[model samples]
Target: MPKRILEMTAIEVARLREDGDHSVGGVSGLYLQIIGASRCWMLRYTHLGKRKRMGLGIYPTISLAVARDSARAAAALVQTGIDPKRAREDEREAARMHDAKQLTFKQAGEAFIKEHEPGWKNLKHIDQWKNTLATYAYPKIGKLLLSQIDQAYVLQVISPIWSTKTETASRMRGRIEQILDWATVHGHRSGVNPARWRGQLEYLLPNPDKVAPIEHHEAVPYEDLPQVYKQLCAIKGQAARALRFVIFTAGRSGEVRGMKWQEVDLFRAVWTIPGERMKSGREHRVVLPPQAVEFLRNQPRRKDREDLVFPSPRGTFLSDSTLSKLMRDHKINGVPHGFRSTFRDWAGETTHHPRDAIELCIAHVIDNKTEAAYRRGDMIKKRVAIMKDWADYATSETTNPA
Candidate 1:
């Protein structure tokens, strides 16, 4: 029969040190130290006629019982002709691969922007993506791996600012979802994107549009328009003239700022804006009213200038914000763009002008295709009448109540 070794305590081991012989029972084999202070458990093993040493664990922390269990498990692996060290190394490699698949949310967002920014029509869109994401989302989960980001982290990023800045928060959520979806499809992440909406995240958050309704540009009442128009006329500056031109042509600030002298036909009382400058990317001819034509004629022309009806003092075109700031400085609460809304309100409430003709005069893309196709001539005669009425009303003493 094999010798049965008794369980020895720490105190007994210390006493055995004085006696010059010590042995502890381990599961796989015997714990023996050939010399004092050089303590180790030797697992008796022979593989293919070569002896091997398997150190169990260090003393104190690795208790006698646990060390014995570890030695026994190591021996079992050897018995099955498997190398335990190689198995541990394989597990470490798998852990590294799993970590490699996860990407930080900020990293994925930047990648998404770089891939999609070139296709965007507006240059401001790219800046908006960077500014909003960096300000809001980056501070929260910028370091977290994409796969580790759950719905709770997404909520934390948006919920604080969601109510106050509803539209921006809504856009932020959409951008976050887009990046995460890209990560999932590209094999950098697994499982559903936590930022997704519809049935998935609908239950988690409130409808953004419902929280903050769309705000339309407030239109000046037609009755008060003459007073406002006279106030605008009272102001004397290049910005004032540019703003008046925008009001007269019913064109956007970009269109007015980008207008060239060549497009204006003074003899014929017309201005034909080119396709590139126009928002619709279609050439639009504006039938200049007597006031509109007179305003352009009185505009001071710079020497050696070839183009640009509204050139700055430095001979460059005026920026879009220049006229808007001038309006605000002059105590005009609304802006030059608000004049378009003012015109629409007057046409709707105070004038007999047809809706299609008014929309066409303003270069608005009317949805009725057949009507648009048939009305190829732009109803110039009717538009002339409408413009004359608008000039008269804008300069006259009239008031729209409410």
Candidate 2:
């Protein structure tokens, strides 16, 4: 017969100093195993006539009361004809899977941007996303789980600035909605997008158009163009030349700044801006006047691929503020963009030319589908006369009106 073991007291368990194993025999196969001064609880049980040992936890770290409870639970599993060791392994695997699937809102937004940024045309667009999200969305719920970001939290991000900075806040809402949609598609999250505007946020927030007042850029008067043009011409630099070209062509500042030598056809006196550069995503053909062509020819524009016609001091693309800073330095009371409006006003008030040709010259999107289609021809011959007249009027300071 085997000798019956006595259940050890708390004082006896505390007195244990020697290494090896000590059994407190109220429960079968429960031991306080001490090895080289470290102590822990282990359950030595038999399943299917095979001895199996399972660790409960460390002594003093996991209190003896908790260890006893854990051992009894493992013992109960054995009484139910189940293996507690396999159960514990299954639990650990489940925890690993849960951790692997977790995604924070910042992580998801970054992943979404990385996946889609290659397809975007403007490099500044990525900066826009980073700046807006970092300033607004990331603060409120960036570290929160994707499943945790509900519409209430999204509203918290946009509502404070929605009325004050309506356009920016509106754009932020759209971006957040897009990120959530991407999350859903990739299986990181599941639900109708909380940031969605039409059926959700639109009802909560006031329409941006109704709340925000329209503010147009301050434009130079038509009669003031000669004076502005003279000052721009007198300022000698790439930024000055870029400004003059913008005013002369009525093109966007970005289009003028991003111009490569390859895009200009001086022999034909035409500059073709590719679809990717134009805001309308269509190629724009600008008829260069003799003076305009002459200005460009004097630029030492070598026929080299990717050579910018107007590069910054470092030979990279000029910053957006380059022309504005020139305007400020000369104390010119108008902005670079304001020059486009100056051209538009001049075209409207000073010319007898048809409106369609002028709008097409500035690359404005025509409202009438039929008119827009006819603009495919873009009235090039008529535009040459108009642009020449504009160039002559702009440069002369006192040219007779055509």
Candidate 3:
């Protein structure tokens, strides 16, 4: 028979200051473990002929009354053939998993961005995601748990901006949908995404297209392009040269502004834009005409492959605004992007160039998948002839309409 241990009162337990384990009565195997200044509650028990110690909690905070109850519960588990220490560990693990799945909306968005940022080619795109969420979504549902978010919360973020900044609001809604989908896939959230546009959100929000009609960039007419080209040649500086280069190549302002010396080949009359730099995510080979080649030959050469072809006065990438301002200062009608439209009109209306060749020169993606698959080569020979003819026509002295 086991000897009966005396149970100690709260007052008696409080008086224990010796630096050793003192058995606190009312529960078997319960002790006040005192080591110098440290005091805590520890339970000692035997499982399968081996003794084990388990920490209930720290002293004072987990009082004598609470410790006794916890010890009894642990003892009950041990009596039922379970290791109380193992059972407690399992409970802690389950709690950790539950907490992990309760991530806030902002937390889930940040995690999703971090996970996918490696695959994103542009840092600006990553910044855009962060900025949009911070500006709109974060203020509304950032702190709310992913499981708690619904259509109402999503509308709270985007509704005000929907009618005013329709495009931005539409993009924000799409991003929210993606983040919610990512959370569901990762087990941080469950249920249908409230931000989805196709079936759910479509019924709720008014059509974005109807709210704000799409606006194309204003372009110069092809008939006036020759006169415009002549006037552009009169303007001096890198921005003017870059604008001319854009027109010559029929390239986007962003593409031309970010061009590096390595991309140019004066010897071969080719400017190869790598897939990463191109909007289509595919390499584009531009066949430079004599005028375009001459323009490149005259620019200051650099030893560094990464040096910008048209750098700013500070020796950095030229801003799109600089080119736009140049056009404005000289009273040139239409924006810099308008030149692409100008080039397209000239090629389509005036020239006898094949439709495919003209489209390829402007780096336009073919709408027909079968046609694109069959047209494997870039048709560089056709493009070279077309560009030369366009350049000659642009540089030619034409009488302005009287």
Model 3, 136-231: lDDT tens per residue? 999999999999999999999999999999999999999999999999998888898999999988999899999998878888898998888888
Rank the candidate models, highest lDDT first: 3, 2, 1
Clashes of each: 3, 0, 0
What is the model-wide C-alpha lDDT for candidate 1?
Answer: 0.76
lDDT for position 243 in model 1: 80
In model 3, the Cα lDDT at residue 333 comes to 84
For candidate 1, what is the TM-score? 0.61
| Positional deviation of residue 138's Cα in model 1 after best superposition, in angstroms | 3.7
**Global fold similarity of model 3 (TM-score):** 0.76
**TM-score of every model versus the real structure:** 0.61, 0.67, 0.76
Query: Candidate 3: where is the Cα deviation over 4 Å?
Result: 1-92, 118-124, 302-306, 370-375, 398-402
Candidate 2 wrongly placed segments (more than 4 Å): 1-103, 163-167, 184-192, 207-212, 302-306, 370-376, 398-402
Residues 1-402, candidate 1: write the lDDT tens digits.
223266666655434443222347545454644355555545555555667665655555565677667777767877898765455568779999887777898888888898987666445678999998999999999999887899999999888988999899889899888888899887888887788888776887788878898877655666777787777777777777788777776778777887788899999999998876666768899888888887787888776465777888787878868887887787777767778888888887888888888997888877888877776687888888888788777767523101
Model 2, 176-287: lDDT tens per residue?
9999999888878897999999988889999888889666877889788888888776667889889888877888899999998889898999999999898777899998
Of candidate 3, the 10-residue stretch with the lowest lDDT total is 393-402
> For this target, which candidate reaches the highest lDDT against the unseen true structure?
3
